[model samples]
Target: MSVKRPNPAQWLWYAVGGKLPDRYREWVLHDATAPTWLVRHVIRRLVFMAPILAALYLVLAVMMNFDLTIVLVGLGLGVYAGMYYSLIFSTHSVDSRVTRHGYPDQYASQVRKALKQAERDRYNATWRNGGATSR
Candidate 1:
């Protein structure tokens, strides 16, 4: 089934662990060959992450009596640390998600790789097409 194209708002939802509301099983989650799949996934994850980190930083700042400089430093350190750790265990996260969506666990890597290639191709295609990225 074809999914209705998601609006920017829905994409934000997708970032936050919500399943793609449309064509999730057939396209976004399963096909892995869609041009924007890899980039789309990464963007979604990052979108999901921003608010959480902001909340963390806010709480820390409040506890520290609103020291903006210290909060910034801590936020920077937290971002770097979070990125480092997420990379180390990214596969487990992907595999678990894939499994949750009913795909075989072992297919996780393949799916991701395909999605990456598709995104690359799409990006190149956009450059080739007069710098206009079509949808």
Candidate 2:
């Protein structure tokens, strides 16, 4: 059986989905010292906000007291701003907290291990197929 090479689009799709390839998934998910409470806190905040924001948007849209186009634009901007803050500020806050206690370095080391394993696998496959030649 031939090994199926990943296409460029597959790599892009993986990036868009915020995932690494299968070989790295295990290592990435392994958290040696994850602060469970912090993770839960962040998750709860996101879960709580999603429905509240949706309900507010729906109520505003239904009221229709303001101009529909303006309301829609404002709603769009609000959602965009919220997501931007979450992605930028919230993530930095979490990372900083994690790093201050050294969780980030552990995570980075795990990721590097996974990447190295992937590279070794690729090299071995190529060598087995006679792609590597001795000088």
Candidate 3:
């Protein structure tokens, strides 16, 4: 026996309700590759992150005004923020690569290749100029 597929609109509604639309999976997967869909995905992820960050900041600030417990909570939040930012923003970082492109591994490889080519060009230019650099 064969299963009937659900309508695309119904699938979207189900998806919004946190349910997987097995019937429309192929169509959804195909649409995910479109530019508009990709942009929407990025915006959705960022929108989700912003609220959590704001809440964390608010909780930390409120805690800092109280007693020792609050102070400790605030300190923990500060450490978390510092580590998170450092890991996300470090040179040639995975998070940075992902944000610039879409996927981490693919973007990392591309960045590595670009850096290697740039270094090779600089080396060749300096060697041709007898170790003198060009601006």
Candidate 4:
């Protein structure tokens, strides 16, 4: 399938966990399976958080009269806790996202394993097949 980049509106929808149209299937697959997928996912998640965080900052620091520094630190801690769990469930998250876009279950993981097969084979040959470990 050919890769077609989603427009900004589609990307914003995607960032907020909305599914893209069928035309973006290949892009979704590539986005979830590419080498930089982890970083991309994190960035996407963070983008989704931006507006919420801004609203939170306004509520805590402005309306509630909390100290700006304290509010910022509190928000930072909240983000840290969220990111911890997000990373832990990242694989499942990606798989779900890809599936929501109409791909098969675990398609990203399968693609990644396939993409690395040659490199994995080389590593096994070097380490397990007496290339250097046997010495």
Which residue pairs of candidate 4 clash?
none
Show the colliding residue pairs in model 3.
none
Local distance difference test values of all predictions, in order: 0.64, 0.51, 0.49, 0.89
The TM-score of predicted model 2 comes to: 0.38
Candidate 3: stretches off by over 4 Å = 1-50, 57-65, 68-105, 127-135
In model 4, the runs with Cα more than 4 Å from the true position are: 122-135
**Number of clashes in model 4?**
0
User: Residue 114 CA error for candidate 3 (Å)?
Assistant: 3.1
lDDT of 3 by residue, 1-135 (tens): 444445666644433333344554444333333335435444434443555656765665564445656656765676567556644543334333243333444454455456668888898877965686569
The better-scoring model by lDDT among 2 and 3 is 2
**TM-score to true structure, per model:** 0.58, 0.38, 0.31, 0.86
**Ten consecutive residues with minimal summed lDDT in candidate 3?**
92-101
- Candidate with top lDDT is 4
RMSD of each: 7.9, 12.4, 12.1, 2.7
RMSD value for candidate 3: 12.1
Q: Candidate 3's C-alpha lDDT? A: 0.49
Give one digit per residue, the lDDT tens place, for model 2 in 1-135.
433334556534432333445544332233212335335334534554667667766777776566668777986777677656665554444433334433543453455457778888888889965586787
